[model samples]
Target: MPKFLIVGATKFEIQPLLTYFKIPVHSPEGLFSTESGPDISALITGVGMVNTAFALGRYSHNLFDYIINAGVCGAINKDLKIGEIVNVTNDTLSEMGAEDDSEFIKYPDLNLPGTNYYENQVQIISSALNGLRKVSGITVNTVHGNEQSIAKVRRLYEADVETMEGAAFFRGCSRLSENYFQLRAVSNYVEKRDKSKWQMPLAIENLNSFLISLIEELEK
Candidate 1:
C-alpha cells in the first residue's frame, strides 16, 4: 500500500479531504491516520511558511509514497472564480530574492538564500493533475493585495495564483520522498481585503467535490 500525505494550512482546507476519505482527525497536529482510500493521511498545519514547512517535513519522512499539499489560495487571474481549483505546476517564493537600490534580484532557481522548492516532484505531480483545472502558483510570505506585487509576480513567474504555503511545503519535501503534489482551491482574489468578497464557504463545498473525484481517480 502506498502511503499518501495531505498537508493544509488549516482544518477547514483539509476537512473535505478528511471526511471524504474517512480519516479521523488527530488534534494538536490534525494528523489523520487511515488504512483505506489510497492509504492516505492528513494534517492541518497552522498558517504561514515556517509552520507549514516544519509540519509537512516532519510528517512526510520515509512514511508516504506521495505527499500532497492542498489548501486555499488567493487567485490573481480573474478568469478563475472563487471555488475553482488550481494545480500547482511549480512553486517559487515570489518575495524571496534580495532587493538592492531599486531593482529586485532574481536568485537562481531553487537557490533562494532561505527558501526551498522541489524540482523533481513538481512535474510528476502536475502530470497526475494534468486534466484538472489548473493555474500556476507563486507562493509569497506576505498576504498580497497591492497591484504592484501582483504585477511583479505575474511578470516574474507568470503565475495565475498566489499562495502562502505551497513553496514552503515543496521546499520541505525536497529531501524527502520524490512524489509530492500541491492543489489549491481559490477562496478569494488577491485584492483589497474584503470579508464580504471572500467565498470560503463556497470554496469548501467545491473542495468536497474535487476531493471525491481525485480520490476516485487515484484509486484506479
Candidate 2:
C-alpha cells in the first residue's frame, strides 16, 4: 500500500472529504490515516505560502508515495465554471519580484537564475480524474481584488486560476516527493473581491467529492 498525503489550506476546504471518509480529526502537526481502508493521510497547512512551506518542511522526512494538494481557488479565466475542479499542472509565484514605480518587474526580468515557476511532471490523467481540466495557475500572497492588479498578472502569466498556496505546495513537493498534484475547485471569478458572488459551498462540496473518488481510484 502506497502512502498518500492529502493537503488542504483549511479545515473548511477539506471538511467534506474528511467527513465522507470518516477520517478522525487529529493534531495538525502530524499525519493521520483515514478510517476507510487505504493508507491515506491528510494535513491542513493553514492559509498562505509561508505556512504551507513551513508545514511541509517540518514533515519532509515522512514518506509519501503521492502528495495531493487540494483546495478551492478563484478562476482567472471566465470560461471556468463555478464548482468546477481542475488539475493544476503548472504554478507560478506571481509576486516574487520588485515593483518599479507603477511597473512590476519579475524575477526573470532581472536575469535571475532561480525559477519562479514549477511544473508537475508526474501528472496522471486517470479515467477517474480525466474529466477535470488541466490548467496552469498563479499563487500569490495577496489575492487579486483590484482590477488593475488582476490585469497586470493576466499580462504576465496565462494562468487559469489563482490560489494562495498552490505554488508553495508545488515547490515544496518538487523537493520532497517525485509524484505530486494540485487539484483546485473554482469558487469565484478573479475580477473583484466579492464574496456575494462566490459559490464557496458548492466549490467545497464538489472538490471534496472529487477528491474522495480520486483517492479511491488511487488506492486500487
Candidate 3:
C-alpha cells in the first residue's frame, strides 16, 4: 500500500476528515500516524501560498508516496456547479508577473527564474481521479472579489477554477513526491463578494464525503 498525505489549507476545511479517521491530534501539529488506511497522514497548512510552502517545505524531508491537496475553490467557469469537485491538472501563480503598461509578463515567459507554473510535473491520476473533471487552475494570494479584478483574471488566464494554495502545493510536490493531486470543490462563482450566494457548507460536505470514500478505497 502506498503512503499518502492529505494536505489542506485549514483545519475547518478538513475537520470531517479528522473526525472520520478518528485522528487523536485534535490540534493537529505535524505528521500524525493513523491506522485509518494504507498509511495515511494529514497536514493542515494554515492558508495561502506562503503558509503552504513553509509547512510543506518543513516536512519535505519526510517521504510520502502520494500528496493530495484538498480544499474548496471558486469556480471561474460558470458551467461548473456549486458543490462539484474537480481535479486540477495545471496551476500557476497568476499574479506573479510584471506589468508592462497594459501587458502582463507571466512568470513562465521570464528569464531563468525557477517557474511557478507547476503542471509540467507528471501527476498520478488514479481511478478515483479519472472521473473528475480535469481543469486548469490559477492560485492567488488574494481571491478575486472585486468586479474589475475578477474580469481581469477571467481575461488573462484560461483557468476553470481558482484556489489559494494549489499552485504552491504543486510546486512543492514537484520536489517532495512524484505522485501528487490537487482536488478542489467549487464553493462559489468568482463574482463580486457575496457570501449570501456561496454554498460553502455543501462544498465542504461533498469534499469530505469524497475524501472518506477515497480513503476507504485506499484501504483496499
Candidate 4:
C-alpha cells in the first residue's frame, strides 16, 4: 500500500476525517498514523505560513507517495458555492514580496530567481465525487477581509480561493514528495468580516466526506 500524508491547519478542520479513519491520538503536538493498513497519516500544522513550514520540515524525513493538504478556505470567486470542495491545482504566496509605498511589489518585481507560486498536476477526478471544480488559490499570511486589500489581491492573482497555509503546504510537499494535492472547501465568501455568512460546519462536513472517499479510492 502507498503511504499518504493528510495535512490540515487545525485539529478541528481534520477531526472528522481522522475519526473516520480511526487514527488514534498518539502525540498531542505532532504527527500521528493509523494502526493498520495503507500507512495513512495526519498532521496538524497550526496556522499560517511559518507554522506550516516548520511542521512539515520537522517531520518530513519519511517518504510518502502522496500528500493531501485539506482545509476550509474563503472563496474569492462568487461562482464557487459555499460548502463546495475544490482541487487547488496552483497556489501563490500572495504576501511574500515587499510593499513599495502604496504599490505591492512581488518576487518577480524584485528579479528573484524562484517563483512565489507552486503548481501540481495531481487532480481529484474520482468517480465517487464528481464536478468538484479545479481552481487556483492564493495563500496569505493574513486573509483579506478589507475591501481594498481583497480587490488588490484579486486583481493581481485572479485566484478562486484564499487560505492561510496552502502555499506553504504546496512548497513542503513538492519538495518532499512527487504527488501532492491541495483540497479545500469553501467556507465563506471574500467579503467584509462577517462570521454570520460563513458556513464552516457545512464546509467541514463536505470536506471530510470527500476526504474519506478519496482515501478509500487511493488505497484500492
Each candidate structure's count of clashing pairs: 0, 0, 0, 0
Task: Note the residue pairs that clash in candidate 1.
Answer: none
Give a tens-digit lDDT track for model 1, residues 65-108. 67778788888888887888777767777777677797777666
* lDDT (Cα, tens digit) per residue for candidate 2, span 11-105: 78888877777778775544556766777778888889999999899889888988999999999999999999999999999899888998889
Query: Is 1 or 2 the stronger prediction by TM-score?
Result: 2
lDDT score, candidate 1: 0.73
Between candidates 1 and 3, the one scoring higher on lDDT is 3
Inter-residue clash pairs, candidate 3: none
Off by over 4 Å in 1: 28-30, 35-38, 109-128
- Cα lDDT of model 3 by residue, 1-220, tens digit: 7787899988778778877877655664456657654577888888899999999999998898878899999999999999999989899899997888988888777775687678934544457767788889999999999998988998888999999999999888889888888888899999999999999999999999998887666556
Cα lDDT over the full model 2: 0.88
TM-score of each: 0.84, 0.94, 0.92, 0.94
For candidate 1, the 10 contiguous residues with the lowest summed lDDT are 118-127
Q: What is the lDDT of residue 9 in candidate 1?
A: 83
Candidate structures ordered by TM-score, highest first:
2, 4, 3, 1
